[model samples]
Target: MSDINNWVLPEGIEELLPDEALRLEKIRRDLIDLFASWGYQFVIPPLIEFLDSLLAGTNSELALQTFKLTDQISGKTLGIRADMTPQIARMAAHHIKKCDAPVRLSYLGTVLHARGAQIEKSRSPIQLGAELYGSQHIKSDVEIIQLMLEVLAVSAIQHVHLDLGHVGVYRGLAQQAGLTTSQEGELLDVLQRKSSDEVVELLETYKLDKKWVNVFVQLLQLNGDVTVLEQAKKVLKLGDASVQQAIEELQEIAALLQQSYPSLPLYFDLAELRCYRYQTGVVFAAFVPGFGSEIARGGRYDNLMIEQGEQVRSATGFSADLKVLTRLMAVILDEQAKEIILAPDVLDENLQGLIRELRTAGKTVIMQLPDSSKQPNHTALIAKVNDKWSVS
Candidate 1:
């Protein structure tokens, strides 16, 4: 006898039923249209690639989350993509190199992770995102942020709270303090946890100057509303020039976002170092009231393409799990499932023609089969009236 566990799926993997799949498809089409309206051409990268190319310039976190296997043909290690950013970066560098102007690209595909994120438990997520390449101006960053917010709005996800940060803040301080790579990593680990005690202990253990230690500790508290920017300007005034520049960049981006979305709840976190290993500049993520983790995130990675053996080009974008967005939308939006029509299984050319006509008119027509006891849920049915095919 076959084992009962044969049908069970791996943990964190999932399949969507008919209703959920329909909803997800509809949202996918709508989002792709939205991106197109913004001049973002859609692209589909491969699900797997050479491990080195797939993980190029990405942090160890991504490498840890990737599943690796040997390619029988080439005898080389290949990785199932855990993220699409690196893949897209390579595409921009190698494939779309002829054009010098900024390129806007969007993609929707499934990404498999070896381990799930802290709050999101799914290891297989349908990732949907847009990337803008070849520009590093503050306007480019603001545009990406605006587009991200627009994406959430289109998905009917409400009450979005955006948290903004710049890794340069911490990087600048780490450099000014002359902290070694190992020491910087240790400090970063504690800063991410917001453990002020550990941060002080580590700093004292390193014997850093009081000025650097004070600023480093102050980084942990530089969070909250817009006023935090003013505090940051004064507190980081004595640090590296890049620290001051990062603060200014954040200020400018915030002002633009406020102008475009005056009622948006925006927060700042100086100590936030998301994807710090590759992100060169500003970083941001969106959240909702009950969600314990960010729903979507992206940041500038000016050096990623260079690491791919191509010329340096600035890039920034945002991504979210399409499945998660669809789930959240289901809760917020009223049910408006499409109408499905049932038809008789009789072998009649006229009936077949009518079914075709109905389907052409955007109606879902499911023909019944002979000797079948299965019943389908349909909103309407096709019937014979006056010797003609009609929907009743």
Candidate 2:
């Protein structure tokens, strides 16, 4: 007998069944092709990186999730990537050239990590996304958002909401609060989680002004309708060059995107904001039902090029968690039911030929079709053609 202990797979990891696997494969093909249609080039970055490279002042929450160990050859701390954005930024900075202007990239692959789940989720996830580098135009931001929606539209995920924010908004608010960096970070964490009480406590503890405090609390509750932008000025008074200017940025992006995705919902949350130090402009999180975490997330980072010492430019992008997308919406996926070509009484040559032809054409072809004779209720589309060939 096989030793069960030796054969057991690790917890939180899963095997994709044939049907599930095929569905995911189709999802990938569809999305990659969709991205290609928009001139976004395919890029499969290596899944591992020197730990220091990825953690270079990135979100501490993200750094904690990495599956870490020392590299055997380099003797350096190497780790599985928890996020791909930093590497994408690095790749753009290193190669891709100065004149490319807007370098568009797309990728679909597994990202391994430990403690992969966020506050409520408890499973490691497979993430897929695309990035737009260079070009700091607000149009680039709207374009990426439209593309994300298009992917969902094609995939038949109808109810999608993009909760957009300006990273600078809260970061600016943090500056105005006059709290130390550590206090600001803790307050940001509370806001991100939507814990209003924690946010209120922080505002009081920091002794922020009443008007600013009111705006801070309202920012946490910023959600629903583009009309919120119109009301923002009354609620949150701009502090000359700080948080107020950041609010203006979000409102500007909202107006630009609303013309295209007019029904697109907009929101503001001062509490749940972070200075993705690299993210210089608008940031966003995409939510869809069934997936416990953000389905897709990205933002504009105009400083990465300058950070690497280049002429200033801007870009924005997003990554859709293809694994979660396929799994959660399996029922709606066109490929949910396993389809088999129902051919019968055909010679082995013809069957093999058909299978090979379809397989080569990139269709997931099942060798054997369902047999109603053997099972009595098998449902499959049987090819209805006589052996004699006729010219039409």
Q: How does candidate 1 score on lDDT?
A: 0.88
Encode model 2's per-residue lDDT on 1-392: one tens digit a residue.
88888977566666778767877788788888999999988877788888877665466677777888988999999878877776776777765575565788877777766764654443456666777877666678888888887877666665677787777767766676676888766776777777667778877887788776766678777665666655655565654475567677677777787788777655554344554555777788777765566776777877655554445456578876666677666355445443444445546665566657756876554334345345222235335358532111
Over the stretch 109-220, how does candidate 1's per-residue lDDT look in tens digits? 9999999775447899999999899887999989999999998888889999899999998998898889999988889989999988888888999988888888888989
| 10 residues in a row with least lDDT, candidate 1 | 329-338
Which candidate tops lDDT?
A: 1
| Highest TM-score against the true fold, candidate | 1
Q: Candidate 2, overall lDDT?
A: 0.68
Which regions in candidate 1 have their CA more than 4 angstroms from the true location? 330-338, 373-375
Candidate 2 Cα errors over 4 Å, as ranges: 5-7, 118-124, 193-197, 207-215, 267-270, 274-278, 289-292, 303-313, 330-392
- Count clashes in each candidate, considering only residues at least 3 apart in sequence or on different chains: 0, 6
Q: After superposition, how far is residue 376 of candidate 2 from its true place, in Å?
A: 13
Worst 10 residues of 2 by lDDT: 375-384
